[model samples]
Target: MLLTLDLNDQRPLHEQVAGAIRRAIAEGSYAPGDRLPPARDLADALGINANTVLRALRELRDEGVLEFRRGRGVSVASLVEGRLAIVLRLRELLEEAGRYGYSREDLIEMLKELP
Candidate 1:
């Protein structure tokens, strides 16, 4: 999968990385149990610090979308069996937006309203 990060954007680099990976997972680009690139390799490819990639992976892991192994590195979590994972992801995103002052109504109107 190809990932791109915009350094000029206001969002943190790690967030951009996490979001890209999340979107990829949600869209079935990265299947369950697929191993991700090493943090150092991904960092080099993205022209960012290795810690940034690590942070993104850690966040994904915390959100149950990825898992970290001692020797196997990070792999996508098994989420194909249920809708709970998707619901949890949406809750997390909305809660995160709330932290930045976005209300549910605002998000619904902006994101849910059809064009």
Candidate 2:
């Protein structure tokens, strides 16, 4: 799997790494049940610390984008497509909300008001 980091991005390194992995998943570079490179390998490829990559991997696993297998390392989740679609759409919605000067809390409130 290919992962790219944006030096210009102001987010924390772990978040950037997580976002890169997320993009790769959403772009179909990694399919359901595809095993990812080991954390050491991913760190070498991205020129980041191994711990940083592990942190990102843990976050992705928690988000259900990836799963941990005892002998298989990490693999993309089988049901990721639907989750990715919603995540991508929510990202776009947040970007649109930002353009309109809407706070994240405002979006949360809107969600709360939804039936």
Candidate 3:
């Protein structure tokens, strides 16, 4: 899979990395048991610090979207339940944004400005 980080983006690199991985999982690009690349390797591939990659991995682990074992490396977790919950949360957020008079374009622009 191709992972990218935009140096020009206002959001931190770690958040972007985590978002990429999360989107991959949500879109079925990664399965529950799929293994993720090592932190150092992914860092090299993305031209970022290894610590940044690790931080992203840790965020996913904390969110129950990834599992990290001592020797097994990181892998996508069995997040079927979490997946549904996240979908529901996103829907709710979209509805909330609409209620606040935020158009879809406005939401997209706001997300683009996140940091």
Candidate 4:
């Protein structure tokens, strides 16, 4: 999977990494049971510290979005219930956008324009 990170963002590095992975999963770029790149490799690719990637992966694991194995690394968790986790995550995103001054109408307009 192609992962990108913005180091200059106000959000923590680990959060950025985790968010990218989550988006990939939500958009079906990475399906359930797909193994993510090793922490060291991803860190190198994103120009961030390996520990940051590890922490992000751990957060995903805690959220049940990923499963960590002893030697196999992290794999995407199967979808819970019948829908993609994006349903709940989109709510959180909308709430956060509202906090950042995006009106509901503005969000709706953006969504309407999405392919």
Please identify model 4 stretches exceeding 4 Å from their true place.
Answer: 80-91, 94-115
Candidate number with the higher TM-score (2 or 4): 2
Q: What digit string (tens of lDDT, one per residue) describes model 4 on residues 2-115? A: 898765778798988888888888888888888888989999998888999999989888878888888988898876323447644675878799889998789889999999
Is candidate 2 or 3 superior in lDDT?
2
Q: What is the clash count of model 3? A: 0
Query: How good is model 3 by TM-score?
Result: 0.72
TM-score of each: 0.72, 0.88, 0.72, 0.73
Candidate 1, run of 10 with poorest lDDT: 79-88
- Return the top candidate by TM-score: 2
Query: Model 1 over residues 1-115: C-alpha lDDT tens digits?
Result: 7789877878799999988888777777788999988999989988999999999989888878888899998999877425435755777889799899998888888876777
**How accurate locally, in lDDT, is each candidate?**
0.83, 0.90, 0.83, 0.82
Q: Which ten residues in a row have the lowest lDDT in candidate 2?
A: 84-93
At residue 16, give the lDDT of candidate 4. 82
Error of 3 at 97 (Å): 4.4
lDDT of 1 at 38: 92
Q: Clash pairs of candidate 3?
A: none
In terms of lDDT, the best-performing candidate is 2
Q: State the TM-score for model 1.
A: 0.72
Please rank every candidate by lDDT, starting with the best. Answer: 2, 3, 1, 4
- Candidate 4 residue 83 Cα shift, in angstroms, is 7.2
lDDT of 3 at 50: 96
